[model samples]
Target: MEFGLSEDQVMLQETIRRFVADEASLDTIRAIADQESGAQNVLDEKIAALGLDGLLVPEPEGGSGLGVLDAILVQECFGYGLVPSRFLANTVAAYAFGASGSELAGNIASGAAKFGLVLNDVVSRRDSSGIQVSGTSVTGKSLMAINVRDATHLLFYSDDAIHCGAPDETSVVKTIDRTREFFEVAVAGADPDAKTADVEQVFAVASVLIASDTLGAAQAMLDKAVVYASEREQFGRVIGSFQAVKHLCAEMAAKLEPCRALLWHAAHAIDENDDEAITMAYLAKAHMSDVATFIARTSTEVHGGMGFTDLVGLHYWFKRIGVNRQLFGTPMVLRERAARQQGLVA
Candidate 1:
């Protein structure tokens, strides 16, 4: 079978690329990052205006009704631009609600509600943290909750079930990447009526999307490094003329290029409900984490001292890739999960 993105998918990719270039320039991203609150709302409105919030919702319920592969394409553009929005969290919540046959799926489709996702517990649980669900109520704290400040509801897993409720309070969790918001959310006696979707499947979708984001960010770093190498001079010669620099750029491309195909297959597996979808997602996430880190480090080295400077702004993409590496599951965690799934480990 011929395996590639269809014509429409290519167009969708291009369209989003154009949108990112026009709206999410470094200056705009910097301004948003400087704000103390609602930093993501600026870009979120623009995404909503473009109707991207409906990217994963079913058409019958007023959405584009696209699949995970298409969502991956959009996410790649967002990552490339370092756009700060809740597209990742919202997409996962939509999938969870739709899969569970919940009425809230309509609200997500119409962009009437936004959701913060607490998925860290799905991978590694913390004894001192995590929410607990009781009869129609959820109470406790969830750390590293995505998009909590603006979320109308919180989607989390507890006691082997999916729960959604309003957040009673939120406190920001500072990290190296200020481009996106992470929070410690507190919920008390809130609704716990969300229907359950397949937990593994929801996590698989999240892993794939996060990996796609890293792929885009790494691609951007590689592109920038190549551009810098061509123009930056050293001892009356462009850095690109040096064999060592040439090897570095080549190695980055060699490693990062194949990640696109890896992510494509993983996303396709999820959409098709293939037997290997879960394992593929874990593998893709793990592989991208390793490759993206290498690219980020090598690309910065190519820029010499300037890569670390704010004027060059390479750190933004560098930090974006850094954060993506840890989200959902780190490389170590994901590889262990993949091995267990394949019966290769106890």
Candidate 2:
């Protein structure tokens, strides 16, 4: 069976790659890193123009009605650019709602609203007064939410359902990654009755998209490291000619390139609703998380002192991959999940 991307998919990836290369370069990422509200109107406009905002929405919802594979492609490009936008939250929410056949899914696909997702596992129950969500709010403290300020609605998961609420941004954490922003939102209450029974599917979608993003960043870093090694000369010749530098660059490729196939398999499995989709997605994420972390380190080490400096701008990709690795659980945790699926562990 052919595993490579189709012509259209390849074109789509190329188009977004060009857009990121030209419009959302490292310099642009650096400029927006320090903002309190990381909402970029122009970035959103550009994405909307391409109809990327509607990529995962079903056809009846006024979207392109694409599948997980398409979204994964664009997200990978977003990773390569290291562009700080609300794309992840937007796409994931659309995927969740659309996949579950929710009415709210229609609105999002039509570009009527944007969303932010806080991946906290909240407990919920129905009570005499109404639906209640525990740990949704406590002394105005909540888990860190990505793109909370940019979202019109805040989504939280509880009891296999998704609840929507407005955000109270009293305090937002200064996370390690400057290219992206996160907020610990204080919500009034997440309506437990809002939406139900596919939170696991949504989390699966989120995990693959994130893994694709890290893969992109890792690829970019490897490319930069290889180019630099080939150009930068030492006492006698270019550093890449040396065994150590060549090995570092080669190892990065060996680790990162194979990861693309796993990501592709995971995305395809999800779209096909294959039996192994969940386990495959987890495997892709676990493998990429570890690979990305290693590539980030090796890529930087390849650059020598320049890698650590902001002038080279490699740190943006470095930190971005690091952040992605932490999200959706660590490599070891995800590996354990994957292993248990195959009856490899107790």
Candidate 3:
């Protein structure tokens, strides 16, 4: 009946924020531009040491066996810090593998293996015998292929099944967000007989984490914009004293706060297996995408000219929001899909 994080979840979120602030500071991210993968390894090790890699893995498999709500708490912190990692892909893959009783799930849970997501549409066809699985050329230019260089496997789904294959090689592709790297991958020949797990549950899980990420970044932008407004002065008065600046900050907060409830409730809905979980998750994703985009744009405006420059480093958060907005699906795409699911559209 209550809609709030428990004491333990709050502590978990606090712990992650402290670690990110101390270990993965803005300066740390700035220095990693030239060699992101190397820096990413260092970051991954720290995350793994925290056993975050195992957050969704079962206790028997060396993971926390935590549910969706708990995952949302941790992911939100990752977003606030703008920390880059393939933890989201790994989480979805873990769910698929764990649900299917794959031993590889344990490897992933223990951080023994890493994976990347194929965010593009994929097709799988049974090769005559209804077993030899072969379909699309998954190894190509994907828009949001995170952690591809370091991932031992590239994961995608088709025909209601999860498929994993090693990437032959990957080259870093420049995206607007330098806080993280995306790759144009040359997917190596996948094992046609690779393990496959079919379920819609992983989709919901991924959507919730993404929504939580939006929540974190949007919240950070709002906070930074507020702080900056109060400090900068124009015409002998703090800019925040101006009605326009105050309204901008207020409007951002007003739009962003409600996204938190939508995300939290969606995460809770999935964990509880509530009937509305799918629609709720879709709503969370669609709504937060809009919220995040608004915060990113307005927050930058609040900072004026300095906002667009790397000197301020606000662009990192801003670009991350842009990437998240377009990542899994755009706001319109998600909304239309939700409508179809609710039978409001054909």
Whole-model lDDT per candidate: 0.86, 0.78, 0.77
Give candidates' CA RMSD values in order.
Answer: 1.5, 4.1, 4.1
lDDT of 1 by residue, 1-346 (tens): 8899999999999999999999899888887778745545667788888887677888777778899999999999999988877788889888887755666777887877888888888777678788887787677787888878768887787777667787788899888887888888887554545757588888899899999999989999999999999999999999999999999999999998899999999999999999989999999999999999999999999999999999989999999898888888899999988898889999
What TM-scores do the predictions have?
0.96, 0.90, 0.89
Identify the runs in model 1 with alpha carbons over 4 angstroms from their true place: 36-39, 189-193
* The best candidate in terms of TM-score: 1
- For model 3 the local lDDT of residue 64 reads 79
Q: Between the candidate structures 2 and 3, which one is better when assessed by TM-score?
A: 2
> Against the true structure, whose lDDT is highest?
1
Q: Score candidate 2 by TM-score against the native.
A: 0.90
lDDT of 3 by residue, 64-110 (tens): 78878888888899999888877888887777676556666788887
Model 3 TM-score, all chains together: 0.89
Pairs clashing within candidate 3: none
Model 2, span 168-216: residue lDDT tens = 5535767689877776566666544455566656677888998999998
lDDT for 128 in candidate 3 is 24
Give the residue spans of candidate 2 off by over 4 A.
36-39, 120-141, 191-193, 339-346
